[model samples]
Target: MQKVTLRFSHNNPSCLPDYRNHSRSLKKVLQELNIPTWQRKRIPFLYYDDELVAAIGFFVCQAYVLQESEPSLHITWAS
Candidate 1:
């Protein structure tokens, strides 16, 4: 399974204790299975910044996925 270290923000070095464990499990399962791209799921997390945050999961059903994506600035500024 693919593993990744996710930090909600630069200020928060660690995730909440409760969610830290579960989040790890979810990520593992998601990585191992052949999930579809259109199937959207949200991984709930507890941010160290004292707030709850969630990472939206989108499985591309492909190998070697990149953890993050760069927004299309041109599209955003076009309007």
Candidate 2:
């Protein structure tokens, strides 16, 4: 699994890419996992201190397991 951070504010920051762009990025990544269209319609989320900060799974990822072999889980973030 990979780690990422996303900061959201009323005024967009130059450091962070536009949140609207997450759809395209998520689609590209989920394509590899063969995520269904229905799931794709689901929203992504982000949390801060157990508080929901954003619906931006497309923004930041938690963990993904592509495959498993006993105690092993082959997980990779979409580039």
Candidate 3:
């Protein structure tokens, strides 16, 4: 398969179907952001390696992103 450095976005994650993992991501976002139920409905999702392991902001959730010459990407965030 070809390697791609997905410019991860809530509008588009460029990944495959993974509902269970995606749900977990929703939970994480809810817990992390402490957003209300209505607001929680708004935050989009992205899947990294078949898992919801990252978060991105609409205007800005993901703060730092580091890339290597590999398919793997490191995403970080801080309050």
Candidate 4:
């Protein structure tokens, strides 16, 4: 069985994704929009005509926490 592993470092509280194999990151995406990368709770979400365009990943805070299990990621793409 193939098992996936998530590295959780106690040194850094923020759970950042591993970018070793990733080409484009959140910072790269936001750079296209000319937004500065800052540690914040509310990230800049793009919306068009009341609809979510894309997630640039300029999040300000953690979305949520789970009690006994891994938290589910929910993206609100407005329409």
Best by TM-score: 3
Report how far residue 60 has shifted in candidate 2, in Å: 5.7
Among all windows of 10 consecutive residues in model 3, the one with the lowest summed lDDT is: 12-21
Best by lDDT: 3
Q: Which stretches of candidate 3 lie over 4 Å from their true place?
A: 1-29, 58-79
Residue range 1-79, candidate 1, lDDT tens digits: 4333434223322222222333333344444455543442433222323432333342212222234674322211111
Q: Which stretches of candidate 2 lie over 4 Å from their true place?
A: 1-24, 47-79
Candidate 2 residue lDDT tens string, 1-79: 4343433321211122233333334345545457676775554444343333343444333232223544743334353
Query: Which lDDT value does model 1 have at 44?
Result: 29
Global Cα lDDT for candidate 2: 0.39
For candidate 3, the per-residue lDDT at 50 reads 47
C-alpha lDDT score of every prediction, in listed order: 0.32, 0.39, 0.40, 0.36
For all predicted structures, in order, the TM-scores are 0.19, 0.27, 0.35, 0.23
Stretch of 10 with least lDDT, candidate 2: 8-17
- The TM-score between candidate 1 and the true structure equals 0.19
Q: Compared with the true structure, what per-residue lDDT tens digits does model 4 show for residues 1-79?
A: 4332222111223222223233344455346557544532235443333333334353322222234577555655333
